[model samples]
Target: MALGTIFQHDTTDPLAVITAPSPNESPEEKAAREEREAEARGISDLIDEELRAERAVRKKEEGMVKILLLGQGESGKSTTLKNFRMRFARDKWIEERASWRAVILLNLVRSANTILHALSQEMDDEQFGLDDAFTFDDYYRRYRLRLSPLLQGVESNLKRLLGAQPEEIEPQKQTHPITLSPRTSPEFFVRSRTWRNFLQTTRGPEVSGCSLEQDLPDIIDSTEAIANCKDDIKTLWRNDIVQAMLAKRRIRLEDSASFFLDAIDRLSVRDYEPTDEDVLRARLRTLDIQEHELRVDDDADAPKWKIYDVGGSRTQRHAWLPYFDKVNAVIFLAPISCFDERLIEDSRVNRLEDSLILWRAICSSKLLSRTILILFLNKIDILEEKIRDGIMVNRFLPSYGHRPNETSEVVKYLRQKFKDTVRHCSPEPRTCHIYTTSVTDTKTTAVTLISVRDGVLRGYLKQADLF
Candidate 1:
């Protein structure tokens, strides 16, 4: 019987002989053959549709306005990028929260290690222009015996979790072989799935046979200890000896270390999920350019925005050139709070001074002259805090003559300075908009992003003859 007979009555008439093919062919065979052909044609049509859709998507992307984020390292480029994701692509950002756990842990552990280093330096009298506040021998002895072990434990844990550098791996080859260094390896962040897996693991990495501490603590460990022992950490941090030593060494402890220090209790919990603010505060040096495609609207006709964030270190500046020609606009972030700070790579160079020079280079560059330039005078929150804490702007920047050491005064002075720098160096002498921003503040940053999007789109639409 023919399969078609299952769906419809099988009837035969003498008139049907006009459509009959061969007398030897069975009705069932012809029915099954026609069904298979139908399926093949349906699949072919679906495939063709998919190919056309992909081509259309690619074509749309080619016209998407590309915005390049440019600034010095630690200048909040990554944080601004995070703001865009949170505002426009919340679903994807939520999905990646787990991966950021490792980064947050890494930042905390690094801060602890830095504080320990400073303490060690004080013990050795390595930092000049510092008087020993601990006249009693027991203060030194107790801190050394107690805090030293904790610091050692933290460092050992960090090394274990991050994996050893290529050179250090051979030394521990029997235990854990050379994979990649999360702290130093540029490729690990961008390419290594092994590292990414380590980040996503819930329980944390298994420590090898090295029992430096009874149990290697995770981020939770450091946070718990710091929180429970808040008084101890605070006393140690604000001790005249530590403060004087930090000041002499010009270490910006507040910027680098305060995030973990401030929220020690909250971060220690095993069940703790990182909030948007936590993610913003979490510091990881971006080692390469990251590009994210954002959908401004759900409609298929909506436009796409391509945002690029590149590493801003001195060596990383070379990578910026490759992206310059393609960008429709550039958002340059200069952390104005860094006026009193020095670059980590070069202590002699003032951070603000370095930023100004980088800005000048960018503005004057022939490749970027026609590119829309928007400056974010970023980290205003930190600047306001520093001003309140009695950090005089003129002390570091002598050019600011007779200005009051207040937030409003400092902002005004810096704004004028930035505007002057742009005016003096911009190759095209066009008006550049500057925004005082704290990238960590989502609501404010989101609003700023909206304006920025509109401005960039206006310029881009005009260029594309769409306006």
Candidate 2:
């Protein structure tokens, strides 16, 4: 204040006052003052830059639509999101394919383990009356011979990524052990930072062998070993002992490791590349929500698409509310085939009933009243197969009374049920864009995706009064 008053009130030459430094000020003090001024300028520039960036993001979001994939666990939400990437951002998908190799191998190993466990169950349980034909020693010997190498390879891969097995990697106790079958239990995902680091840093080791015998030695040897023992697998599947056990337990072999059993010969091949269907059928549960951004083009005006793949389990639903307000649309996946299945979180609730309750709550929520809703009645393929196998709908869904158990009739009935639920519960009456989707089928899903995109765009435009 004293310096300011002298400058303002004193009768001094203007040029002398402006050009002269204070007489008592040392060179060091002047230098420090300059340094402080420069830092202040830098901070001011940074703030301006951040403000510009914020504006750009806001502008981009104004033109972009954010889609949230929602469903109960195993309802194919992630698979649907993967299909979007496969269609729109193919280059990125190809780049990530190498990482998926480990996941595919893990899937194969888990399948083999499951089959061994089922066989073990048969030998241990007297209720199945299967002890006379199948002994643990014989089955165990066959498993060790045919599957041990692959299991070892899986272990090696896991060790490289995690330095620990899947069970040892942050193992958690089951929340609903009674309701969930071990088969339906949540499986591991290759989403850890350690896995990413391994994939990025490591390289495959070289091998020396004959061309015929060791083609693709870098491709895990267990893969070749499994391929070589296809005959043994088929024999195990067709064994009279297994057949008797199946009949006694009425075990639906078609549902679990049956896919691997059927395709052992093809999957075991050294050159095998996973198709879109193979990736979809791979059963790693979503542990957390994943976000992917796609830019349609490099043009300034090209719209950005932000797609969120949310975890759909009961426990994971709590994380969903934070995302609801800003979402432009929701692609709700409901598996029509899960009518006979029970939820892994709570066994008392049938899977289909759980889906209905979830759908109703979503439809009725005021926060999402303006959001476009596209209902994917997914897994129709599985539903058709189940119906074909004489799985009576009324046995599990008593309300589906006296309905024809044929695929077409059952699908139609299920569709109407969803339609009715939406009509009754939706806060703002709106038409639900429903599709009977087999998300595993690429062609069908692509077509449905186009339709959904158009529907969501139209809804958004209408909301903005720009349509």
Candidate 3:
């Protein structure tokens, strides 16, 4: 009876009658039609399964908090992320502490080489008295020859650690693998996602192959190379002539993010491990967006956080849009200390001005309008240092208008400026938690982070009706 009904429906539909299979269709054609239908059904099932899985994961992560770290290059975004990892993901930070030894070694080498070059340039540029000229020339020739091997090895050592072969990658203007060497770049750029892997690889083996420290303690090969020239490094770094050259030429190595010159004695030993402060202070520039997940607490029900540290150079700003989706908050770091400094990318633009431009743009983005905005007027320590050194805020920013050039007053004034930018530029009403931070000072930053964590938890509680 069912078969007869099916035949009746097919015969009654005029369109079906015309579209029906040919009465003289071959067996091969019938098999092909059935095969095509089966394949189409299989594809549809696969897509449905993926959709279901994605939804399930999304539901599981309902309590997850997503925070994006945005700032200009050298504004301390990566440093801020390090603090989060140190506090929330303590075990991982400890595990990776040894890996940072190589980077620190590289930083020290870079500082030495920078002085070497600066001394060379000073000798070439200046026609000092006979005694002064003789002293500089001797210093230049002796240290340059001694540090020459390190100069040669640093580039190769850095490349091997980054997992890039000479033939595979080429350095170009406005691109990745920006040399950590000061001669080429003031900031070191690395692939963010695999940041620790390369550093870990180079930790103990490549610099001095067959060293037992690789297996025992993870002391990097750069340690041995650096150890060989430790005295020369110390002498040159502390030399009156070198300091004079740096000061007069305005090559302030002390002002750079990778300033490890102060800790040469502690850092130059084999089996050396980076202290938490050392790790926090280390310089490793991020090239692309890096995602790190941390369990904010030690409970089964603890909220997981997905922190995104995006690259902050002008060219990298376009990559930030996709991450603005579903973001819970943003921590925008504006380095107020850089008021008198200019950007590495564009010399015409002051660093503090670039930071302000970035802050305003972030404030005005409609996508981020509803998200929590935390403004870190970071590097307060540097600001205070500059202020005490008689650097006037009014000199760079006439709008500062002769405010008392004290740290507290400067911070207060800049905080108002940042707050005003958000007030005027945000697409809608929002709350911005502004903090004067010196992120490298982990002790103080810990207190700041506690407030940040508490606020995020409160929001989650309210959402779950448990507050």
The TM-score that candidate 3 achieves is 0.84
lDDT of 3 at 319: 96
Local distance difference test scores for all models: 0.70, 0.70, 0.77
Candidate with more favorable, higher lDDT: 2 or 3: 3
Ranking by lDDT: 3, 2, 1
Error of 1 at 403 (Å): 2.8
Can you tell me which runs of candidate 1 are displaced by over 4 Å?
1-60, 126-136, 148-150, 159-235, 238-241, 254-256
Worst 10 residues of 1 by lDDT: 179-188
The candidate that wins on lDDT is 3
TM-score of every model versus the real structure: 0.73, 0.79, 0.84
Identify the superior model by TM-score, candidate 1 or candidate 2.
Answer: 2
Supply the global lDDT for candidate 3: 0.77
Better of 1 and 3 by lDDT: 3
For residues 187-297, what per-residue lDDT tens digits would candidate 2 score against the true structure? 565443454444343322221121222213444565666676567767776678766655555443324256666777777776777666666566555456688887634
Candidate 2 least-lDDT 10 residues: 206-215
